[model samples]
Target chain A: MALLILPIIIPFATAILSLLFRRSAAAQRAISLLGATALLGAAIALLNVVWSDGIQATQMGDWPAPFGITLVADAFSAIMVTLAALTLLATVVYSLADIDVRREAFGYYPLLNVMVMGICGAFLTGDIFNLYVWFEVLLIASFVLMALDGDQAQMKGAIKYVVINLIASTLFLVAAGLLYGLAGTLNMADLAVKLRDVARPDLVATVAMLFLIVFGIKAAVFPLFFWLPDSYPTPPAAISAIFAGLLTKVGVYALIRVFTLIFVQDVAYTHTLILVIAGLTMVAGVLGALAQTEFRRVLSFLIVSQVGYAVMGLGLYTSGALAASVFYIIEDVVALQCLFLVSGVVYRLNRSENISVMGGIYRTYPGIALLFLIPALSLAGFPPLSGFFGKLALLQSGLAVEQYAIVATALVVAALTLFCIGRVWSDAFLKPSPAPGSAGVLVRSAALSSSRAQMIGMLIPVVVLVALVIGIGLLAEPVFGLATRAAEQLWSPSDYIQVVLGEAL
Target chain B: METILAFVVGGLFAAGLYMMMRRSIVKLIIGLALLSHGVNLLIFTAANLTRANPPIVPDGAKQPLPPVADPLPQALILTAIVISFAVLSFALVLLHRVYQAVGTDDIDRLKPVDE
Candidate 1:
């Protein structure tokens, strides 16, 4: 019980302490780092406990099952919690050097910690309404973080982000209300059990559609992804890295949770629709990435595109497919974040975000070029990398299910992703730097660091993440094994219901 | 009362969506506010309103008496109200900052981040 809530508590404590120490940048950074480390420790503990013990559930104030709010960690929830914690730690490490003092003084660390709390809480909660609240918690924190710098681009992007996400939250609230009205319960496990017996299948399907729309918007699927690319790249790279890494994945997680556990009755209709959306999202996202000349913008489009792969796993709705989705998310989170931080380094060095204006990175900074190449190739699904295994699992599962159309689309998108990545590499790294007085150079070159210490501080997270991605790739078998176990738990909703509701239901 | 409120809720939804469709940034925020109100009312209506007593336990009673209004939706609404209020205020403040930064109330005039 105590273990389940530690992830949330540690971050909240850290955020308050940091906010109190906001006047002193050093104190705030130290407090934030300590809080993040504590969070990672708590998350790993929860994961270990869940791995050894079947599933863990704790009711708030001992109110018991359906009557009280519950925090439950099944295999899937535990893995997500651990992944979120890991990403939070990496983002904090990167922010040490990437973030400016002005932003740091303006409560950046506090907001980041609070956002992590919301993320961990979202992953741990067993109640549907609690999940909605957690989403709002993270959304609010992200809104401030997105606009923390208060620049023109940031403000414009923030408005679009704020408005669209608010609309999605409102819709999510409506869906929660309607589900409660139908089932007379807010507890997700209990609702799942009760919804199975509800006589009005059509009404339930209507509510399911409402949920799909809500999560779809949140997940940045197909036509609903405009706000994502518009807003994500405008934030500082550390902020963008976390957002790119976790936010939409949370939406995908919610979609998977609800669809598998509660909305399984109409899989023929809903899952097929999801598969169609997945195909379009892949094609559209990669095409958008191919069109972009900006560094982070290309990566932003890839986030949208990569989500399609995860959603495709959900659409396939098999244990293998679900496991593939989980693997894809874990690998993509690590690789994409590494890419974003590398983009930050590149921007710092070249003093430009436009790939057309940036050049000679490979010639000038071989190590940075290598850092970019690893994740870039991984994201492009090259062999002997984490992404290759993720794509292989997804493709194999898609083939086993005989989803030929989506399978073909996935293959085509893979090729396009490679081309897009190759284009970025050629323009941003391989091309020789334009002559000193050339029109292509928008700004003079800026050194990544004036001192060795600052450079190492910035490089540590990027290097660690690169190693982690490589580790995930080399140890794909064990990681995929864990994912398969998580998928099994998701495949069998009865286990979740039993653990969450117990004898009370 | 439910019937009338249903129509009122529908009216709010329509008006909110209409307002949101306009190009003005302030109108969009107002529309968001209206939309949330509509959702709250919908929750209340969907939970089945009653003219019965409030859900308070009487002396020597362990649970709320039967023939009382459902209290859960009210609790849910209270939470919804707080969250939406916080979000709305933040949105308004964002609106203010955006206007100051961009020198316009027209959302259409705002450029894309890449631009």
Candidate 2:
């Protein structure tokens, strides 16, 4: 029980401490790093417990499941929490070098801790309403972080991001309310049980659709994702890294949870809708990236596209498909974080984010060039890297289910993704410096201003994350086994509910 | 009475959607407020209505009587309302920030950095 709650508590406590010490950058960084290390350790411990003991669960205040809030961790939630804690650890280290003292003084670490708490809470909560509250917590924190500098572009992005996200939240509230009206419980396990016997199946399905739309906005699916490209690129690279890496995947996680757990009665219609959305999301997102000249904007659109691969896994709805989705999320999160971190370094080197203006990073900083290629190639589904296996699993699942159209879309999108990523490689790395604004000369001069400490701070996280991406690719079987277990639990929730509420409670 | 309130909720939803589609940020916020209230009432009415007695167990009963309103949805709405209020206040402050930085409330004029 303590194990189940520690991931949430550690971050919450760290957030408070970080806030109290906000005025001193050194103290704040110390608290934040200590908090992140502890969180990662707690998450790993919790993962071990859940793996050995089976789904660990505890109800708050001794209240039973339907009447009281429960915190539960099956393999999937534990894995997500672990992923988040790992991301937080990497980000905090990166922030030490990347965040200006101004933003750090402006409550960055505290808000970051709050966001971490919110994310972990969302993953661990056994109640639907509780999940919504956690979503709001992380979101409000992200809002402040995105607009931290109050630059014109950041402000514009923050406005669209906030407004659209608020609508998504309101929709989630309405859906949760209506679901409660239709069924008598908010506990996910109880709802899964109650919803099976509900008299009105169609109404339940409509509520499911409402959930689909709500999470879809957050996942940045096609036709609903215009706000993402506009907003994501405007934040600082580290802030962008965290948002890009973790936030959208939470939406995907919720979609997988609700569809797999509560509203499985009409998978035929709903799953197909998801498949259709996944196809369009892939096509539109990659095509959108093709038009973007700025490095971050291209990456932003690429995030939308890659999200489709995971959603496609859910759309397929088989155990293999869901397992593939989980694996895909792990690879994508690390890759996206690395890509954004590299983008920041690229900005430091070239003095711009425009690919047209960037040249000769390969000649000047081969290490940074290699770092960029690791994620860029992984994101495009290159061979023997983490993304290759991630995409292979997804494609295999799609083929098994005969989702031919989406499978085709995935392939076409993959090729186009390479094309777009290739655009960056040629412009930023391989090409000689453009005649008038020679990037090599500019970078050499700026190296004086860009302190070596800052460079190490940025590069350390990239190295750690890239090593992870390679490790996941090399050690695919153990990770894949874990994902298989997670999918099985999602498919069959009896163990989950009984663990949470007890056998007879 | 339930039908009348349902219509009122529908009307608010319509107005909210209309306002949100406009170019100005302030109207967009007002629209959000209206949408939230509409959804809250929708929850209230959808959970089934009762006025005969409070949803409390009597002196010796283990459970409230069937005709008593379900207290769960009411509690859900209360939580929803508070969350929406918190978010609404945040959205308003964000709007003011955007306006200060961009010098415009119109959404169209705010696209200075985009392609």
Candidate 3:
């Protein structure tokens, strides 16, 4: 119970403290670090508790589940919470050296804390309406963070991000409202039980599809992804890393949660829809990446592409497939963050995010180049890395389902992703620096102390993440077992309802 | 009553979408405002329309909520309105800064460096 609530409470409390001590940079950093560390510890502890003793739930204010908000930490939520907390801690450290300290000291840390709170809350909540609340909390924080620098690019990005998210939030609200009207309940577990009793299958399917569209926009799937690449790159590197690591994954997590639990019987239509979208998302995302010459822009496109792998697993609709999707999501979040952090280093070294102007950086920053290589190759599904295992599992599962066309397209898209990332490597690191670059001067100066600090701070977490990915890859049996358990829990949903409502309907 | 409210909400949603697609920053703000209002109304309607009274307990009553409005949706709308207000203000400030920095409110003028 304590562990379930601490991840949210720690950050929120620290955010308030940060605001009160905004004028003191030292105090702000201390508070933020403390909060992040506490969150990480809490998340890990919760994971242990859940692993030892199944799923856990705590009703806020001691009210029963149906009438009061509940914070539930299942295997899936536990893992996501831990990942979000760890990424947040790393981003905080990265921001210490990278951010314009004097300008951002007051608001940035608080906003980041609030954002983490929202994310953790979103993962932990058991009420549908409360999930919407957490989404708004995170979205609002992201809007401020996106526009933090208040530059032209940031503003443009912020506008598009906000408008798209606002629309998505509205859609989410409408879906929740409709669901509540039909079921007369807003509690997720209760709704799952009552939804089974509802006679209108079409209405259930309609509301479920509406939810997919809303969450789809957030996850940057297929036609809904145009806003992501356009907006994400403009934020500062720390914010970008956190966003890359956590935001879309939350949407994906929600999609898995709702679809698997509430709409399990509609797998034929839903899975097919997901399959078609997944294929298109992968192909289109890589194509977008191929068309980009900018470092962050290409990374953004890859985010969309990687998301398709996760969606593909869900579409396959088997225990192995769902587990693979879970694995892919975790791998994608870690690998994407690593690549984005490396891109930040590239931008710092070259003073340009455009690949056309960046060259021979690997010679100057071998360590950073290597860090970038790990995630890049991993993302391309290279052997021995986490990304390879995730893709392998997804592809194998798709084949098992005899989704041969999807399997073939996924493989082709994987190749294209490899090509696109290789292009980024060549253009940005291997090739000679373009002579008389228009973006900026090509004066190869030693890295700034601040930049070096930022790089080291960022690299530590990437290293940790990569090592974890490798661990998961090596010990796939246990991890996949846990994921299978989670999938079973989701498929049945009886335990979830029993835990929340004290008895299954 | 529910049908009329739904039509009004739908019209507002269409209008908001149209305004959001425009190039002007001010129009975008207006669009968000309209969109939020529509969403609030939609939520209200989804709670099932009731006209008798607000959801409040009467003195010495066991369960005094017959034909009363759903207080949950109303509370949620209140929060949404507050959040949207904050977002709108922040957007206004950001737009002001963008205009000052770039000398234009036209999104087209803010094209990517590659473009």
**DockQ, each predicted model:** 0.79, 0.73, 0.61
Clashes of each: 0, 0, 0
Better of 1 and 2 by TM-score: 1
Candidate 1's residue-wise lDDT over A309-352, tens digit each?
Answer: 98999999999999999999899989988998888888887778
RMSD of 1: 1.5
Worst 10 residues of 1 chain A by lDDT: A442-451
TM-score of chain A of each: 0.98, 0.97, 0.96
lDDT string, candidate 2, A265-329, tens digits: 99899999998998899999999999988889999999999999989988988999999999999
Local distance difference test, candidate 3 = 0.84
Q: Each prediction's Cα lDDT score?
A: 0.90, 0.89, 0.84
The better candidate by DockQ, 2 or 3, is 2
Query: What TM-score goes with each of the models?
Result: 0.98, 0.96, 0.95
* Candidate 2 residue-wise lDDT at A122: 94
Better of 2 and 3 by lDDT: 2
- Give lDDT tens digits, candidate 3, residues B2-21: 99999999999999989988
Clash pairs, model 3 backbone: none
Docking class of 3: medium
